[model samples]
Target: MGLWRVFYAGWQMECCGTPFSVGDDVSWQLLLVPGEEPASRLTGPAGHVAGATDGIRVVQEAGLTVALSEDPEPRSAGAGPADPGPVRRSGLLSVETHGGAWPEVTGRVRSLHIVVQDLARGADGTWEPVPGTRTLRETDRCPKWFRGREFGTDTGRRRRDEQGVLVGLEVPS
Candidate 1:
């Protein structure tokens, strides 16, 4: 079993994700993001995002296919109806990246960890986790994202649903 640290975001869960627990067999669409991407560091300053937790592994790295749409533009662009085209094997994995669906990774959850970080906007307009405000809470269930009055409304200081699960998943071969 290849153990890897996978970051699952909170909004992704609240949108189309289901609550999962340790030892539960689950499948999720995953995007292989380059570590250089600023968003990739969602898991802390060490590169943690407000809602990303680590700890996912892969069984195989190849032999995967992702469904893609031919038209990359928005439907409102007067591009007529959208077509989901055909499924193609993603050899480079980075070929034709878009905002839609991604390849699904399936596996059993080996562990779960929730990440909580208090973030404040800096003078440079970048958000960073506050000192001593980063904590990883061990949980069996993935929590849902919620919007509260105290969230993102305090003069540059606000609480966010930046909680996520570190699912140990098996990337399809």
Candidate 2:
């Protein structure tokens, strides 16, 4: 696991419904599932907006992926509509891969994007999607092999909407 210091510019964010602001000194702990490793520093970026500051994508693993600061754009799959936009990844989120049980990160709801899909499995081996969320038309909508349950910060990774149930990931801007 890796540790990181998060900096927000008072953009109005939350973790699992708990509101927070700049200078909060939130601790971002990055944990990778089995066979996973950090592709780069926890403070390094995976990518950035067309021309914005480059952000870092944290731990990378085969089963689970986590990124700190990056940009993710989720598109509509089949019946799904266009992704409203990428979420601001001031906060990091990630999920266990390989269809294993991943405990939801307990925090305030991220204001930017929700990183979950419709066919996600809970830590208890249940097919649970974000509440009120429908299934994704296909896996193509997600980054690489991630199912619909993947979520990231507004800057890093993909999209989905849920409270503290967000997952941080990395991909192209």
Candidate 3:
């Protein structure tokens, strides 16, 4: 569980539960109970209570009559950094293309996706020839056509051919 404190205009406020920031143009009114001594109060430009202290408790229960008013300012989405979920450690590999000829390209499988493919060992002693795989032909060179191509790498570097065409084959770590 996460714990947080409540505050009003920098002055700490007593609250049994977490307090959320009020949006702009919105006003909040709270009551307080008077104590034996006089309470210190700070009022805002609009006569809204900004801060208070000195023998006064925010009216958590009935019968107390201390009034607090506030018009909170609007909060913009640019006020803070957005929460980017978990960092994904994946890579993309691509083969180079030659003069007017498209290199035969294959996609790399990642994690659980590898289980769905039939696996075989190549002369290099690495797993090769995934089942249900498709090959890229030279005619399919449009950028939009390769949008969903898959490739994996232990490092995040993209693999490319000598001519700089992406081959989409990851070197195993």
Candidate 4:
């Protein structure tokens, strides 16, 4: 079996399950179920926002099947890069798990280490890179993905009011 890591960020943002390691050319469906009350509370008031459940539901229901391989490689569409970006710091969030069917034999995503990446500035100048870490605040709109492909794509969108502040760091993966 090969290992695959899946990440979900945004509203209802707790990471779920362990990294899946399965056989080659295999396809499986993933069901992203609603988290329990304790987990939901951890998300705070931001979890009550509009479309939050829908987004989470999509990730939950869109089960992923892995093609087992002697060589380790992911075969899912929309899968981000293994090395997503530059690593600015250590000790971010990470989770591990054995490969298997959706919603079955899955493990709770504990406090895994992640390398948080640094935020960058845009041409319109809405966000500026600040030094040090702050709480990730809840915003009127959903939190921004700042890095990845979505950055700078929609310049006219309004910024969301931040709620909880998380210390920002840059990770290479």
Against the reference, the lDDT scores of all candidates come to: 0.47, 0.30, 0.23, 0.25
TM-score of candidate 4 relative to the true fold: 0.22
lDDT of 1 by residue, 1-173 (tens): 53334556676677766777777876554554443211211110111122222222211243323222222223675454444342222211122222444445566777777767777767787766677766667778787773322354546555544545555444434
Among all windows of 10 consecutive residues in model 3, the one with the lowest summed lDDT is 2-11
10 residues in a row with least lDDT, candidate 2: 3-12
Candidate 1: residue 141 Cα off by (Å): 0.7
Q: Is candidate 2 or candidate 3 better by TM-score?
A: 2
TM-score (all chains, Cα) for each model? 0.52, 0.21, 0.12, 0.22
In terms of TM-score, which candidate is strongest?
1
Candidate 2 residue-wise lDDT, 78-116, digit = tens: 554333233333332333222222222323222222233
How well does candidate 2 score on lDDT at residue 64?
Answer: 22
Ranking by TM-score: 1, 4, 2, 3
The predicted structure with the larger lDDT, 2 or 4, is: 2
Give one clash count per candidate, in the order shown: 13, 37, 11, 47
Count of clashing pairs, candidate 2: 37
* Candidate RMSDs in order: 11.7, 18.6, 29.3, 17.4
